[model samples]
Target: MSEFVSQLSDSLYAVFQSETFVLLNTVDQESGGPTSSAISWVYAVDHSTLRLALDHRSRLVDNIKANPRVTVTVFGQDTIYAINGSATVTQDPLAEVPFKMCCFDVHIDAVRNALFYGAQLVAAPEYAKIYDKRAADKLDSQVFAAMKKA
Candidate 1:
């Protein structure tokens, strides 16, 4: 197996336990270009798949239906992890939550430590420090913790 595939079962979702949000990249249907956006609600359904919440009118939602392949990257204070996966749209993820929301079940295919490459293979704190002050406002602390358990 490849290094990226090896990392999948080990530390893929380990680092994301504390992360509130991550950068989501969806391919544009017409242009076939990647569009980056910060998704506030995302959680791991299991070790292999992550559930991503997308707004009803979100372009990302449409993009995913057109193309299930995508990437979700998390930049933390000391590490950066990216997951390359395939997404499937799940309608009405949460009944309590208002509005029409679409959920994407992303099956993680590969994982990479973007900012952590060196002689010793350690995370570069310098790169992480840049995003220190940023936080996802819509993040639910309880839900984040719950997913980790699930």
Candidate 2:
């Protein structure tokens, strides 16, 4: 919807890949105060949406139900992509404890470039490889393992 959103798809993808953890910021359900959690269970559903698979025990799920407003901050190469969106939770059962999963359907509202020097930094030749490795080695490992079991 904004230049920040339109132009940053590739850049955001890179960040999403390399970053082992993204900061999920949400407000407290009752107090309406800010809270942030380092999460590794999120992925882009599309350009305008993201899906997060989180355990029901997290307060983040409750916060989303109370107020869908959320901001996901991804980082790498000293660059930050803070994606603003709303969330929709869906119940998904798991074999492990806490059998419920909150699959958040984030609707993109804005993109804030959290950067230094007023823009992005120069990327290295191995940046893409780094991205790929992080995606498979860290982020997707859980999902892949689950698929293998299935």
Candidate 3:
């Protein structure tokens, strides 16, 4: 993997236990471009595991069923990570929450790392700091603890 991918992977591992939300973009079947409809979502991850949950009628879910090829971009305080991978929509309940958790965790980890690695690259240092502060506010410790026990 390239350095970008490695950094993204490690960042994901760090915030997997937190409650940060991710914006998911799916290529439109007709337009073949990313769409903005219902693009935002919450996901969890643990190690290499990823989980996503949505209503049965969600467009993104349908898109994944038809085409597993996906590109997931995660935004951090001072860094952004774009991941290209193949995804499958699974019915396994066990993996869902953990994967979503991991996604948030990784995002936080990435942001913290960016402070040291790319602080000067950001447009506003204060913006990044604000995001870091907000990350803790959104965490659901009870849910996370329950998921781990399962």
Question: Positional deviation of 73 in candidate 1, in angstroms?
Answer: 0.6
**TM-score ranking of the models:** 1, 2, 3
Residues 110-135 of candidate 1 have per-residue lDDT tens digits of 87666645524344332232343434
Candidates arranged by lDDT, highest first: 2, 1, 3
How accurate locally is residue 89 in candidate 1, as Cα lDDT from 0 to 100? 60
> Model 2: which ten-residue window has the lowest total lDDT?
90-99
Better of 2 and 3 by lDDT: 2
Summarize candidate 2's per-residue lDDT along 1-150 as a digit string, tens digits.
224653237656555443356789999998889999977766665577766766778888889889999998777565667788888754344333234555677788888776655676565223233467765565356652332232
Which residue runs of candidate 1 sit more than 4 Å off their true CA positions? 6-14, 92-94, 119-150
For each candidate in the order shown, give its overall lDDT on alpha carbons: 0.66, 0.66, 0.46
Q: Which pairs in model 1 have colliding backbones?
A: none
Best by the TM-score measure: 1
